[model samples]
Target: MEDINLDDAIKLIKDDMHSYELLHDKFLSYINRDPDLKNLVHSYKSRFKDLDHLKSKIERKNHEDSMLPEDEQKGPITQDNIQERITDICGIRILHLYIGQFEAIHKALMKYVNSNELALFEPPKAYTWDPEYSKTFEALGVSPKLKESFYTSVHYVFKPRADSNITCEVQVRTLFEEVWGEIDHTFNYPEPSKSKVIQEQLKVLARVVGAGTRLSDSIFELNSLQDAE
Candidate 1:
């Protein structure tokens, strides 16, 4: 990684910025055109990763790898591998109003993929689904979940078409989860929060967010029962 020139890498990213912008617009159009997605989401947003942030991320990853034991270390990031290694240079986020909507939106996405309405660069993956959340979704019979850190989102790596080399990451999360994520990212990201009080509070807030989601789901379930009655 040290052997690779940072200037050249930044140039590569800057030169490709226009292409990413086009890809972002293309994705936004698709989301808007899909009636199910348009009606399900509370908000939609997208961005191209800043050049400095990209460089810092590469440096951070390499630094962390250096600190690991030899057998555990992931390989370094070099200019040659940067484009292939970093997947989220272009990101799109879809925010839903409630937890219950995730399953429906997820199902819509699967149908889109199966029908070839969208082209995926790789298999879809969900991030930050702890055991409790997994059990909750499993009971709903929506989708299988993976346990990870405190965050929560469904991510898809895809291109305008399979033959296109450029890829963008699409993320889906509830508005409640997005609020918590923004707070966590502001205070604890790039580096974890140093204050134990703040750290503990964030964890507490995560639980609160979880409960809020459950409550929202229960309210919908109750309304459905009443409608049926």
Candidate 2:
């Protein structure tokens, strides 16, 4: 896939000549109805708006890899990079504050998308069994397909009815999944014919990491119970 340069990305984001407003409106409207999602964006936008605090948080988490390199950076304020930043004409992130909140947000999103009757791009292998956690998504009425990477997320392709001029991609991911995504972002996708050994290795890693997360959650719960007692 050909990547858009920083300059081109800025032009796309800045040009009133470009129709980003409609895309933004559609996404905002979708999220506005959900109390959980609205609060998430509000919380993030507030905290992330603080440059020093935001920089410190990102630095502490060691997630600065998502930022564009100096050579790849654009603009005076560096305000724009929508293409690379959001991966869509309209980029919106659905954040889950607690790990347990993922399902609620996901269910809300499904309802909103279904109501809007948007078209989606379903990859053949999208599955959503929380391997590390004791609870299977099957019990939650979720059987989302599983993609290969450790970061578990779904990407949907949606286009507007009024104009087919623009296309948007929606990425649904848990917070932990985003970390996994960043770790593997540099890797290239597999060819149609891929090695089973490579695939097996990745799957094994995913399970192990997921189990670790579940254990952490379990321990936290235990501590909470002890405190209560």
Candidate 3:
């Protein structure tokens, strides 16, 4: 409602864990109903569990912090600075099993969320593996030379269709890749000493992961070949 102020909304959300979960589920329900997103996500049942876990973690973190005294709490939400600018405050990431699934999912998602339906979902920023990263593929000796491009994932942002008051981020990636990437992201990979040693180490680890993916693919292919024979 126009009468509702941004500060009140943010206070309710940031100060109360229940309020936050309520809002998150409300949005997730919307996403699940979306034909393209629903199918893509539901294909893997574990994904729903992952989503629930992620949601719970955020809520728990908030609930813990809210116990602190008001004086210790951060700034007010109603500030113009807060209302006008939007950033990566909320996020959801969908991890797939293979690279082939990436583009398929991407296309479907893009088709689902039109330019108009979006009040604020930022234009999809899609990135696949970088050419430099794929160069490591040769070290692992992936015949046919895996493309040099290795991408972490695709990111999408949007305002809730039902309510334009809040924003959310969506991330998509393959399962193996996401697991590996999560390690790096969680630990702050390539450790910032500006040391070649650290960079090389990360590159090597990344290559091993790539090799694992290739090996998995080969086994799958071999099984298919066996079935055909």
Worst 10 residues of 1 by lDDT: 140-149
Per-residue CA lDDT of candidate 2, range 29-54, in tens?
A: 76776676775432221111222232
| Rank list by lDDT | 1, 3, 2
Could you list the CA RMSD of all candidates, in the order they appear? 2.7, 11.8, 11.0
lDDT of 2 at 22: 68
Between prediction 1 and prediction 3, which has the larger TM-score?
A: 1
TM-score of each: 0.86, 0.48, 0.53
TM-score of candidate 3 on Cα atoms, chains taken together: 0.53
lDDT of 1: 0.76
Better of 1 and 3 by lDDT: 1
- Give the per-residue lDDT of model 1 (tens digit) for 90-140: 999999877778777877776766777567777665555456667656664
lDDT preference between candidates 2 and 3, better one: 3
Clashes of each: 0, 6, 12
Candidate 3 lDDT, 1-229, residue by residue in tens: 1122444434434544443344456546655686665755633211221322433443443454466787885533333433223333555677655544444566555544554444444555544344643443333232122222233555666554535545656676657667666666654532333656755665566767667766665676677799999
Which runs in model 3 stand beyond 4 Å of their true positions? Answer: 1-23, 30-39, 42-78, 81-86, 115-120, 132-151, 161-165, 189-196, 213-229
